[model samples]
Structures are given as structure tokens and as C-alpha cells.
Target: MRLVAPQFQPRTVSAFAIAVFLALTAFANPAGATSPSQTPPRASVMTVATQDRVDTRISGLHTRLQITAAQEELWQKVARVMRDNAGTMDSLRQARASNVNSMSAVDDLKSYGQIADAHADGIRKLTPAFQALYDSMSDVQKKNADLIFQTDHRHSAKKG
Candidate 1:
């Protein structure tokens, strides 16, 4: 699926919605367990792993939309949320990786809950901005935006 810039979609653009969507997409990826015999990667590596993927997605969306000067501010808001969501997940993953060896079953559950909560928070932050942007969009832009989000959501669901 192609990422479109905010300029392309004038009907509506919600930073919060996109952030929430991205978070949901990331979580849908099966963070499959590492083999018991396999050692986890270093913390630095663990934290850095998701950055590139997030950047690429955000960049692609921005480019495709052909965002205009007026839309730049709103686009930045969405992009920031995307980056923040990725960073939050990376931190959660890093923490889990570092503690997995010592974590109890309950601890594992708590960690998972924390990750979920963080994603929720990200969505909350993203919603208002996205809504404002979405409201400003044109009908054509809205359709394009809808298709983009729908495609990404479906793709993530399939992957999950």
C-alpha cells in the first residue's frame, strides 16, 4: 500500500487517528517469542529496530499526499505522533527484552498491559489533531485518506 501525504486528503486528517492506527498495526505484528536457547539482542539494537520502519512509513505517507504549505503543520503533528508511538513501543520492547530472563508470569502480563496502555494513550493524543486535520480536508482528499488508512489497517490485520 502507498502512503499519501496530508495535502492529498483535504476532507479529513486526524493525527490522533493515524497514531492510534499505527500503534494498532505495530501491535498486530506477532512479536513471536525467541527460542528458549536463543539469546536476545542487546538493548541498543532492540530499541533501534522499529525506528526505520516507522520513519519509512511516515515518510512515504507524507510524500504521497503531496502536502501543501498550509498542511505542513498538521502533517508534522501526525508525524510526531507516529514517531512518538514508535519510540514508546521501542522502550516497552527494550524493557521487556532486558527483563524477560527474570520476569515472572505475572510480570509478563503486567508488561503486556503497560504496552497496551501506552498505545491507548498515544491514540488519545493523536485523535484531536487528526480530527482537526480531517475536518479541513476536501471530499476527494477524504476518500484518498480513507483508502490509505483502510489499506494499511487491512494489511496489518492480515499480517497479524
Candidate 2:
């Protein structure tokens, strides 16, 4: 059986795409760095800001899902997975950024493969926790969840 349902694929793919874009673009160029030699300061700031955004998204999702007292534990599990996945992606992004200027074409492709692998691993880890929470949801909550995912997918697709 598929780990993810057909309806969920677009949302997952869109999220992954956005994360990849952000990771790559964060290191692309600085608007007004005094010197090309400067690196860590900007990248560090971006990483912290990116992590904050991840946290905000998780909190937003929790609110949007209307998670209840009983569901809190399951919701936390899902949140933890999300945070961990983001951390993994951040690490990968940092590693790639550190060597980005010197990377050969093959190395660049390999770096992308690492990102893709992380995405897949994240989904693999996320699916069951989300499924458990989803199964526990009331019909109204489930509908809300579905709508949120659908809406997010559309928004991300438009941005892409």
C-alpha cells in the first residue's frame, strides 16, 4: 500500500519543492554584503529565520486543525516529526551551502539527491504519526484538515 494517499501527494510534493527552493535561494546571493568573503553571518541568520518559520507553520497547523485536549499528545508527535525533518533539511542545506561555490556538476546533482532523500525520509517518518492523529480526529476536524492541506497545496503550486 502507498504510504501517502493520492490526495496528499500534491501537498507533500509542493511542500518539498518550496523547502528545496528556499534552501537553495538562501545561499544564492546577498543583497548588500560588503565583501564576497562574508558567508557565515548571512547564512546563519537565514537558518535561524527559516527554523522560526518552520515553528510558525507547525503552530499554525495546530491551530488550523483545531487539535483538542485529547489529541494533544498525538499532535505533539506530529509536531516533533515536523521539527526533526526541518532540522535535517537545515543541516543538509548548510552542508551544501558551505561547498556550493566549488561543487562540480555531479556534486550538485548529488546534493540534490540528498535533499530528495531527506524529503522521502521525512514523509516516511511523518505519515504514520499524521495518520494516527487523523484517525483520531472528529469528522469536522478531519474536514478542516483536508481543506487546509488542499488549500496549502494550491497556494504552494501558485507560488511555484
Candidate 3:
């Protein structure tokens, strides 16, 4: 495009004619324009917890259309949410750890839910952060990030 621009630049008088022709040709039958009534699908971002890691790397995104700045911001928000819950999640893990070895079967199951609830509570507490993060994203990132996040909303801190 740049190389061709210089060659076209010298044709000052003919530029108007060329512009009108191009405009008309472009408007003749637009192939790329999306219909206004068509609704796009929803998506999310996923985080898989790896060994000794805090930052959540995005995974399982279905949409290719996203902006870089929005993606970066989404990553930051996801990281913050996970980090906020880290302490509580870790505590639950420790509790489960201490009891798992000694406890009977049903108690283990019960404790797991409690731990999950605690983790969810942590997430709920960080709701403001999540909302801010979502709001900050470019529209494209938000759309794709939705699909990615839905993959496994529970990146359970308890790999314990």
C-alpha cells in the first residue's frame, strides 16, 4: 500500500476522479460488512494452574478477533482475581491436606465443597476488580475473553 501510495500521490488533479471511482467500486457490493442484526457468539478465557505459578495464562479462546491491549488488560485482571483468592484457597488446601490423611470418606467430600465455597467467596470479593477488568478491555477482547474464561472458570488454587 505504501509503495503504491507514492506513485498515486503525483496525480493531484486526477486524484478526485480516481477517489470517486474507487468509492463507487467499493460501495458497489461490500463483502466484508457485517449485518447489524446478527448477534455474535459469547466466549471466555481459561486459566490452567501450573506448578508454582501465579499468573493465569489465557487458553481455550474460540474467537480470533481480539485487540492486544484488551487481552493484556484481561490477563492482568484474571491474575489479580486469582491472586486475591490465593490466600484463602491456600488455607482451604492446607485444611484439606491436614484432614485428608486422617479423615474418613464423606468428610473429605464435604470439606472440598467448603474449600470451593471459600475460593468462590474470594472471587466474589474481587468482583469489583473483575468488573473493572472487563470494562477496561477493548470490545473485541471482552468478546473473546468471555469464551476463554468459561472453559474452566475454576482454576482451582488447590492443586494441593
Candidate 4:
């Protein structure tokens, strides 16, 4: 039988990674705009989505992932990158809160650019770790890994 963790949910891993990937890209753009109010709501939704995906990934894995030294190191790097991105994410959120329901052209462009860059950094930090995790897993585990993180949120939540 295939070894799998009972609490593991492969869907979670895939979903969360995908969410993070998507949000990081959406929010990292610098050209994004809001009147200092709408950023929070946008950021909040993004943050919620980010957390959900992480939970999904962690809960979905069946195999006992051996966290190697390199993985640990990568985690630190990811953490730092996340830490760096947090402000931009928050800023974007705040901007959304300030500008909710109304989107401007010039400001959104700036904010979008910032959000994209921040997210790019976040992806740069963690995506390789995901690949590493995939590499460490057996065939079955690898198969499930991709199945977890897909979402329609990306298309629906278009960047302003």
C-alpha cells in the first residue's frame, strides 16, 4: 500500500502553493494603485487565501517528508523573503481597503507592479523548495503534489 499521512491532504499543498504563486504575482507589482484605503481589503483577502493554501498543502501530504538540512536552510530563506514581502503585501491590502469598489488606472498600474515584484520575491524564495520537496518524494507522492494547489481564484481575481 502507498504510505500516506492520515492528516495529509495533497489538495492542500497544491492549492496553497498555487495561491501563493498567484498572489505573489498579483500583489508584487509596483504600479498597483489605490487611494490608501482599499489596499487592506485586497491584502486581507490575499492573506487569507495564502494561509488557506498553506494549510491545505501541509494537511494534504501523505508521505512523511524528511526535512533535510538543506530544506531547513531553504525554509529560512523563504521565511526571510516572506518577511520582506509582508510590508508590500500589507501596503497593497491597505491600498485596496482605501480604494475598494473603485479602481483607478494610473495608481493601480503602480500598485500592480509593486505587488508583482513582492510576489515574485516570495515565489523565488519558496518555489524551489516545493520542487525540492517534489524531488524527494516517490512517484505517487509527486503525482498528488500537483493535484492540490490549483484554483479558479487566479482568473477571477485579476490585478487592477
Candidate 5:
């Protein structure tokens, strides 16, 4: 099936770049687990693994951005938003998983809508903090940040 891509606003692109990892990871259900009842144990493990992935992404981004001591405070705000966004996505995923068996078609669609809304909301919350950090970046650091986010945006677009 051919999928139509959502048109992303330019400002949200950077926020989406940060969120793409969480969105991708949130969909990785365990192999052979086809139902909600089969998911609890695996879900717990997946939660930890997902958190690890989020942490690794945060740390990698921080390193790649070459954040200095002076930028640490602003960086912390960005990081916190990223972490919070991941947690919000994770919770929504878990809720959907737990009730999968009981959900109607409309319920399923609404659940998905909730996830999409959360993603948009996350981007909204992330943009300002990320903009502050971006503002604090040196020219070289800004270039690095641009490359990093643009790379992610391209990768995600290709996937979509």
C-alpha cells in the first residue's frame, strides 16, 4: 500500500528529528507475541530496552552537538523534554498494548490518534527548549546540530 506522508512544518522538523527514535522504537513488538495477554512480561522488558534506547539517543545527540559547560543548562532543558516525550509515548504504547484484545476498530483508531496527538504535542513542547539550545550554539556547533537533525529528518522520511 502506498502511504501519504504527513506534511511537517519546518519548525517541527527539528522536534520530529528528536522524536523519531522514540516513535520507531514504540512500534517494535516482540516476535511471536500476537495478543495482549502474551505481552505483559515482554512489555516490561521492552519498556526497559526502550528507555535504554532513549537514553542512548539523548547521550549521542548531546555528544554530537558538542555541548559545552556553558550550554549545559539549556541542554538540560532540551534533554528533559526529550526524556519526558519518550515517557509519554511509552505510556500510550503500554496502554494500547494492555487493551488490545478488547479494543474495537474505532477504539484502535482512536488509540492511534492519541499517539499521533502525543507526538505532535511532544514536538510542540520540545521546539522551544530545542530552540533555546540552538540559539546558544556556536557557529560550528550550529552547523553540527543542523547536520544531525537534517540527517535524522532524511532518514525518517525515507522510512516513511
Candidate 6:
């Protein structure tokens, strides 16, 4: 007997997307390290449909950053990259929902690798836009962005 449900609603997809986003934001960086030397390709190519799930994230960042009218352009660029990343990830998760049961072990590994690659590529596409926005941010905004992106896991149990 099947233990899991068959179809995922849009709401479920959105919740999963947001969860992934939070995980990414919380764990992607360590110790304020420098970003990659290569910048992503021009911002024009990475645009995707702005899903409501991802839009909410962008809205939160906008409010937190206190983005000025002049900074709106850079903010939009970064938000576009974020939306594109989230859309790509959500699509991958949905695709896996059905096929995962049938996939052979090797095929499952390969599929997971592809998903990881997609996530890495999305980060690649996202960084330059974020960097540009970071450059334009005010001192207060920079502090806020730093806190938002950096994750401190000191209390999570040390393994010596």
C-alpha cells in the first residue's frame, strides 16, 4: 500500500519552496567568506515567472532593507534572480515527486546530482545581482543584509 499522497497542491509546493529558501539562506554561507570570483552572466537572461511563494520572500527582503526609490532597480534585479532560482527548484521538486518511486538507485543519484547542479547554477546566477545590490546598499542596509545571509550555528552541539 502507498503511504504517501499522489499529487501536491500549489500551496504545498509554495511551502516547500519557502522551506528550501530558508535553508539555503541559513546555510549557504560560512563565516562571511568571499563570494566566487566569477560573476553570473548578464541579469537579463535569468528571469523567470515570479511565483507568489518566492514573491513573499522578495517582499520580506524589501521591507527589511528599507530599499530607497533609487535602489529599487538593483533590488528588482536581485529579486528576479531569486524568483528564477525558486521557480527552478520548485519545478525540480515537483518532477521528483512522481518519478522518485520508479527511479533506480543509480538513476536516483543522478537525478539528485542534477538537482544539486541546478541549485548551484541558480546560486551562480543569483550572486552577481545580489552583489550589485549590496554595493548600492546603505550602511544600515548592509548590516541587515549581512545578518540575513549569515548563519550562526554555535549552539547546535559541538563535535570535538
Best by lDDT: 5
lDDT of 1 at 120: 72
How does each model score on lDDT?
A: 0.61, 0.63, 0.39, 0.49, 0.66, 0.55
lDDT at residue 150 of model 3 (Cα atoms): 34
Across 37-136, the per-residue lDDT of candidate 2 in tens digits comes to 3222322234676678767877887898899999999999987777676666666666666777777666666666656666667677877888899899
> What TM-score should be assigned to candidate 2?
0.73
Give stretches of model 2 more than 4 Å off: 1-46
lDDT of 4 at 16: 46
Candidate 6 lDDT, 1-160, residue by residue in tens = 8456354343444322433346343322221111122122332332233255467667877897788999999989987777666655555554555466566666665665655666667767776787798889888888876655432221111210
Best by TM-score: 5
lDDT of model 6 at position 52: 55
Tell me the TM-score of each prediction against the true structure: 0.72, 0.73, 0.45, 0.45, 0.75, 0.64
Q: What is the lDDT, from 0 to 100, of the residue 108 in candidate 6?
A: 61
Encode model 3's per-residue lDDT on 12-66: one tens digit a residue: 4232233222212211212211122222111112123321233312221213324
Tell me the spans in candidate 5 whose CA falls farther than 4 Å from its real position. Answer: 1-46
Comparing 1 and 5 by lDDT, which wins? Answer: 5
Each prediction's number of clashing residue pairs: 17, 0, 10, 60, 0, 0
lDDT of 4 by residue, 25-137 (tens): 44443433344323333333445555554344443332234444555654454444443455456556556555655766655655555555556666666667556655665
* Candidate 1 ranges beyond 4 A from true positions: 1-19, 23-46
Q: Which stretches of candidate 6 lie over 4 Å from their true place?
A: 1-50, 151-160
Error of 3 at 19 (Å): 48
